[model samples]
Target: MQKTNAQLRAQARGALAGQWGTNVLIIFLSVLLGGIISGIFGGMTNFETGSTQASILEFLVDNLLLFAFTYATYFVALYVVRGGRAEAGQIFVIFNKKYYVPMMIINFLNSIAGYIVGIIVFLPLAAVIGGGVYLSLVISNGQNFGAIADNAFSGVAIALLILLLMLVFLVAVSIVTGVFQFAAWTKMDFPNVKVGNSLRYGWSLLKGRVGRYIMLQLSFIGWYLLGILAFGVGVLWAIAYANVSVAAFYDEARKEIGDPV
Candidate 1:
């Protein structure tokens, strides 16, 4: 019952198309509710004549909480939601009873560990390259040698640009990692498997089917891109995106694994 990659894909795609409702619903909810939360606090804008802190307080009050809450809740919803046969309330129940704590711990430790490691890897590289670029730019601009080195604004800009680039690179990496994690969860469900086990399982799964998996994941990239482009209108139908994406991936894997897989 071994499945070639193409066979897995076809099976996954077929399963995905069949179960479009589940992921789509979740995506719509995730996007729309996220927006509603944003809008509620948005009008608390800083109209202070000259005080950035005026808005700063407003941003901190709502955003910092939302920053943590929205994401955690959404993931809980996604994880517990199961997206197949579970009701929303059941999903919430799963979140409250079991998943909330462990996932939080696993997610938090991983996040902190990853952040520290990433910074350790990235910062020195940025410092050297960014400083070099700024210095080289200043020298090329025919400035005096002292002035070139002392161009604080240009140095700051260069550093910011490098930081922004790092953020983008990391964000992309984080997303693929997330998909890998989610795929693992889907495959294993809430069985007796530990997080490490799930992660290792996911890595093995990805190794053999990266091409098909990437294709399956990209099926929902449209929802994200469209959600951005349409100023959020696209979020309305995004549930299908999630439903299909997850289904396609899981279904494809099932096909490859055959029967129970």
Candidate 2:
């Protein structure tokens, strides 16, 4: 049977009962390394000014580090959940050549998927804004200020409505595409799995359970808000809690699907 979100969360809390120190250290190390990388490349890339090479290099390094840290967290979570002691050095596991190439491939595919989704979700809003701009220009050419003012009001209203609709589409897209959210986890579970097969396995694991996964995530909102209230200190704990909770979820999910957890 699939575990309830509550059960998974309780399991996470239990697994983390005496392991908070290691988990926090893992989170801290990843954040620290990421900050250092961003700092080094920050001055070299300016998106608006079109610094293409620097921007691409920064993007690549940032994503590689992201995948490495993310999978490392998963590695720790798996160990903790399985009743083993998690070590801080687990963070270096994903840097191995065996794991690095698959991480890059997954990262590339994710970037393409995000770009396509962004274009699709915001296409209407872009069209509405562009058409409004063109119409305003045409109206202003007539030297009719009153007509331009009226057109401006209607255009603003139309643009706002389209923006609202686009936000809804964005949320919908996130939920729909969330099935692939566990691709990295699949790779973590079966290290020898190819990138394509890992994605497929991840999809199969969550094909009908996306809503459950989403709800599990939503359950953390209150904890996250509380963390924010504590001047960001509590967020580290929340992050640790949430990461392990997700690992527990994956463990149970695989078992429920008759795969080795």
Candidate 3:
């Protein structure tokens, strides 16, 4: 039988216990290392004095480094969940061609998907909002102030409704995208697998369990809230917990269904 959300989280907490230092250090270094690279690039390029090509090069390098650290974070998460001694240096360890190539491909694919979805979802929204504003202005033609003021109540109500719908769509997109949670782990576990195949394998594991996977993610909201309450320092611990928790979820899911051959 597959593990319950509670069991998966318990496993994560167990894995993290007495090892919070290592786990948090890995997370911290992941961010710190990325920021350091960006800072170095910025210092060299000096955005204000840099040519267009220099600025573009900096942007590309920065994003590449960010993607590298992201993959390393998952690598550490998988290591911790599987009873390995995760070290902060592993962040740099996973930055090789073997992992970097696939990480960039995955990041590119996800970015393209996001752009397509944003365009599809927002185009109609933009049209509607633009048309509505134009129509309002036309209706309030002769007496702009009085007519708009008279309709302000209805306009505000409509704006609020549109904002609410946008929020709902954003949440739905996030949940749907949860299916890709294990993509990096998939690549790590099967370095021989093609990047596209790795993503497909990950989706196969979560084919019908996205709801449960998202629930596990939602379960961390309270802890995240507490982290925010603690002057934002505790979020580091919360992030470490969340990463390992999802790693545990991936491990169990893989065992339940086995991996791609």
Tens digits of per-residue lDDT, candidate 1, 44-126, equal 66455447865565555443333333333234333332334423333233244355444554455445556675776577766
Q: TM-score, each model?
A: 0.54, 0.82, 0.85
Best model number under lDDT: 3
Q: How well does candidate 1 score on lDDT at residue 17?
A: 50
lDDT for every model?
0.51, 0.74, 0.78
What is the lDDT ranking, best to worst?
3, 2, 1
- The better-scoring model by TM-score among 1 and 3 is 3
> Model 3: per-residue lDDT, tens digit, 1-261?
778999988998888878899888888887887788878877785466577977677658855767777778788888988888788788776568788878787776766666677777667767765666667777767467565545544667667767876865665566445444577788888889888788888888877887788788889999999999999878889999998989998898889888877
Best-matching candidate per TM-score:
3
Over 4 Å off in model 3, which ranges?
Answer: 46-59, 137-159, 162-166, 169-177
What's the CA error at residue 205 for candidate 1, in Å? 1.3
What are the per-residue Cα lDDT tens digits for candidate 2 across 1-261? 668999999998898888898888898888887777777776565654347876677677767676677667767877787777778898787888877777667766776777787788778766866676567868578576566556654766777877787766656555534444467777766787777887877777777877787787778889989988999877888888887887787777777776523
Between candidates 1 and 3, the lDDT winner: 3
